[model samples]
Structure formats: structure tokens, C-alpha cells
Target: MLRIWKWYERCLSIHPVKTQVVSSGVLWGIGDVGAQCITYSTARKRLQCKDAEQECKIDWKRAAVTSLFGFGFVGPVGHYWYEGLDRFIKLKFQLRPKTVKFVAAKVAMDGILFSPFDLFLFFSYMGLSTGKSVPQVKEDVKRDFLPALILEGGIWPIVQIVNFRYIPVRYQLLYVNIFCLLDSAFLSWIEQQNDAPWKRRLGGGQGRW
Candidate 1:
């Protein structure tokens, strides 16, 4: 275990961006795999497959695309964003680390700026990746953005509070990536929009996946 850590640290030192991108890609791929597992179960139950031997095939391409997104966008962008935020706050506010105002400021900026943008990126990218027309992608952004943002509001503020106050700035994005692995799974499943249990539970909201 320690040897693995040493190897990772070596890679991270050599090329931080590349290492992070790869980590995000693999982690996000795993997330998509998890989502696929749930999706398969849901499909079998929903379809009431009579043949016990028949199994749903995993969509490896979906996981691949998810990894691609994480590699190209999420990890690289998150790294830069967190570093820039740390610098900006240090320069602008001059608050000491872990202070109340410092934590609040960090959380506020994340909530106000990054949350909405992150949702936009996820839906728009997924839409384009799945071959939706430009207009269609834009339409998807509108239909899903509000609900996603509402949920993010309920979820991320508290998360950011802990992240900002406790985790060091250097490792913040890494910390987020760990959480985001699971988050990506949920996002993947919800993005599928094919009679997902949550959708049915939420009264069957209309969404074009």
C-alpha cells in the first residue's frame, strides 16, 4: 500500500495535471460502471425478464466517454479552479485558513459560481456526446439545469463547508474527486433518463436524455 502511494506521488510530482486527469478518468469510469450496474438491475426488474440467464450488456462506450470527459475537463479544470480560488481568496480577503469568514467565502464562491457552471458542463457535454443537435442540447440545459441546481443547493453547500474548513487547499480537488466518483455514478444514472427509479419517485419529470 505504501509502495503504491510512493508510485502515485512520483507520478503526481512528474506531471500533476496528467496524473489528476488520469485519476479522474479512471475514477469516473468506475463511477459509470457502478451506474451501469444499477441500470442493469433496474432494467431487469422493470422488464421482468423471464429468462434468468439473460443479462443486460454493459455500455462500455458510456463509461469510456465519461472517462474522456473527466480526463479532458473535470480534473484539469478542477485543479486549476481550486488553485486559483485559493490564491484569489488569499490575495483578496487575507483571511487565515479555516477561519469562519474564510470558509464562508470559499463556500459562497463555489456555490455561486462553480455549481451552476459544473451542471452546465455535464449536461451540455453529455448532450453533444450523445449526438444531440445544438438546439436540443440547449433545450436539455434548460429543462435539467434548474432541478440539478436545486439538488446541488441542498447537497453541496454543506459539503463545501467541510471541504474548505478542513481539507488543505492542495488536496481539495483530490478530495472532491473521491466524492465525485460516487456523484458521477448518480449523474450517469440520472442522465440516462430511461425510467430511472428516482424519476419515477419524483413523479416522472420530463427529461430528454
Candidate 2:
């Protein structure tokens, strides 16, 4: 753990701010793809045991596009929002207000602003790819949004508070990467739950495996 922390610190020292955020965002996106692929592939292999290789194919194009989007959109935006919030709360300078307020504000902004836009982008992509109707996709987005808020907003504030208060600006992406990895895992489970019907039709089975 100490060695890993040292390497993380070194990376922070060497990378530019934009580079760090971009790298972290790309990695986070990759993590999402990886988590989904892993879950899907594992289920396919265990349940079907046929054409598993084909089933396991990761959507590199989708991942790449989404990664670029994340790097361009979420990374810079989240970084700045965090910076501004930190300054607003004087997080580094004070402890009286506690971290809860800052966390609440961050979560609120994320739910109100960032999440809606993200859901739009994601649903748009899904609609285009699946030829699903706009209203159907919109319903899907509505179904997922609350869970996303619970997962993202609920977790991010605590993480951000620790990140803004303690971690240096240079290393903020490192904190985000760690959080995003865990988040990717959670989203993978959520996606699996959502995909159960598709999987059943494809596999003619009930269990995931």
C-alpha cells in the first residue's frame, strides 16, 4: 500500500492537470467498459458455454467514444466544479461547517445538472444503437436515473470531501480514478440487472450464469 501510494504521488508530480484529468477520465471509461464486459462475458461463458468468445467481445468502439466523451466532458467539468466548491467552502482553511455541506452541494449539482446531461447522452447513444423509441429510452433513463443518483451522488460527496480537503490538486485525479473503479463495478451490477431480460432471451435461462 505504501509503495502504491508513493507511485501515485510520483505520477501526480509528473503529470499536467489536463493530462491527469484526461487520463483518469479515459481510465474511468475503460473501467466501465471492462466491468461490463467482464460481467457479461463471465455470465455468457458459465451459462451458455457456446460461442462464448463471440459473446465476450468488448465494444472497443463504444468504449473509446465514451472515454473521449468522459475525458472531454466529465473530467474537466468535475475537476473545476470540485475546485470551485472547495474554494467556496474554504475547505482547506476551515473545518467548522464540516464536510457534509460541501458534499451536499456537490451531490445536488451532480444530480440536477451533470446527471441529466449524462443520461441524455447515454440514452441517445442507446436509442441510436438499439433503434429503441425515444419514449422507451426516456423511460429507461428515468428508471436508471434514480439508481445512478443513489450510487453516484450518495458516494461522491464523501469521496469529494476527502479528496478536496486532503488530497493535493495534482493528485485529485488519482482519487477520482479509485472512486470510479468502484463505481464501475456498481454500475456493472446495475446494468446486469437491467439486461436480465435480454440475457434470458439470448440464453433461454433464468440465472445469470
Candidate 3:
């Protein structure tokens, strides 16, 4: 782990944007694998799968698609977004990094702006990438977006607090990408849930996976 991180740091020094993009893609892909396992486990329990079917079969194609979101969108966009946001807050508001006001402003702006955009993009991208129609993707977003945003909203602000308070601008996105491993799995799980009962409760419709 230490050696890998050292190598990553070296790569980051040489090509920061490229490194973040590749790392985000790889981590999101791994997270999708985790999501598949979790989804399969839930199905196995619900269906009482036989011993022969105990092991989960990973869908590599699906994983690749999910990784592309990280590579094409999250990595590049997040890199600039964080860099720009930090600069804007510093220059616009004249808040020092790690100050209470600075952290609060960042948290507020991030939650209000970036969080919703990220969730919206994830659902829309995943839906369209998997061949869903525009209307279908819109419906998927309507069903899943709010629940995800509301749930994630509670947690990420706290995480960003620590991140903005301590980590440097260059390292902040790396810190975020680490947490995105779990976040990607969560978003994948939510996508796979389809019209689960809880989702129905939140989304105000009757549907099933």
C-alpha cells in the first residue's frame, strides 16, 4: 500500500490531471465490482441460491462503462472544479485556507452546487451509457436523484470539512477520489435497485426491479 501510494504520488507530480483521471477510473471500476458483489449477495439471499451458484459472476463490461464515467467526466471535471472553487473562494471572498469561514463557505458551495450536479450526471450518464432512452433516463433521474443527493449530502460535507481544513488543493481531489470508491459502489447499488420499495416510497410511485 505504501509503495503504491508513493508511486501514485510520483505519477501525480509528473502528470496531475492524467493521474487523477486514471486513478478515478480504476477506483470507480473496482467500486463497481464491489457493487456487483453486493447486489449479487442481496439477490442470493432473496432467492436462496443453490450452493453451486454461490460465487458472484462479475460483469466486466458494466464495470468498464462505470469506469468511463470516472475517466471521461468525474476525473477531469472534478480536477478543475476543485481547483477553480478553491481559487474562487480565496480570491473572491479573501478567506484563508483552513479558516472556519473558508471551510464553511466551501462546504456550503460544494453541497449546494457540485453535489447535485454530480448526482445528476451520474444517473444520467449511467442510464444513457447503458442504452436507456432520454425519457427513461429522465425518469431514472427523477426516481433516484433526490434520495441519493439527500443521503449523500449528510455525509460529504463532513468529509469535505476535514479535506478543506487539512489537505492542500492539489491533494484534495485525491482525497475525494478515495472516498469515491465507496460512493461509486453506492451509486451503482442504487442504480441496480431499480424500483425498490424504499425507492418507491421516496419517489412516490409503484414499481419493481
lDDT of each: 0.81, 0.60, 0.90
Q: Show pairs that collide, candidate 3.
A: none
Give the poorly placed runs of model 1, Cα more than 4 Å off: 51-53, 194-209
Q: Count the backbone clashes (under 3 Å) in each candidate.
A: 0, 0, 0
Query: Which of the predicted structures, 1 or 3, would earn the higher TM-score when compared with the native?
Result: 3
Per-residue lDDT of 65 in model 3: 96
Pick by TM-score: 1 or 2, better one: 1
Per-residue lDDT of candidate 2, residues 1-209 (tens digit):
99977875676567555755676567757776877777786677677755655646666765665566557665677667655755665555454333665555655665577556764565455445556787766655555545555556666666766765567655665677677766655554454466445434443222221
Candidate 2 versus the native: TM-score? 0.63
Poorest lDDT segment (10 consecutive residues) of candidate 1: 195-204
lDDT of 1 by residue, 8-85 (tens): 879878888888888888889899989888877876777776863377677899889888888988889988998899
- Hey, what RMSD does candidate 3 come out at? 2.8
* Per-residue error (Å), model 3, residue 203: 3.7
Clashing pairs in 2: none
Model 2 alpha-carbon drift over 4 Å, by segment: 1-17, 45-55, 91-133, 188-209
Candidate 3 lDDT over 33-129, as tens digits, reads 9999999988988887586367788999999999999999889999999999999999999998899999999999999999999999999999998
Query: Highest lDDT: which candidate?
Result: 3
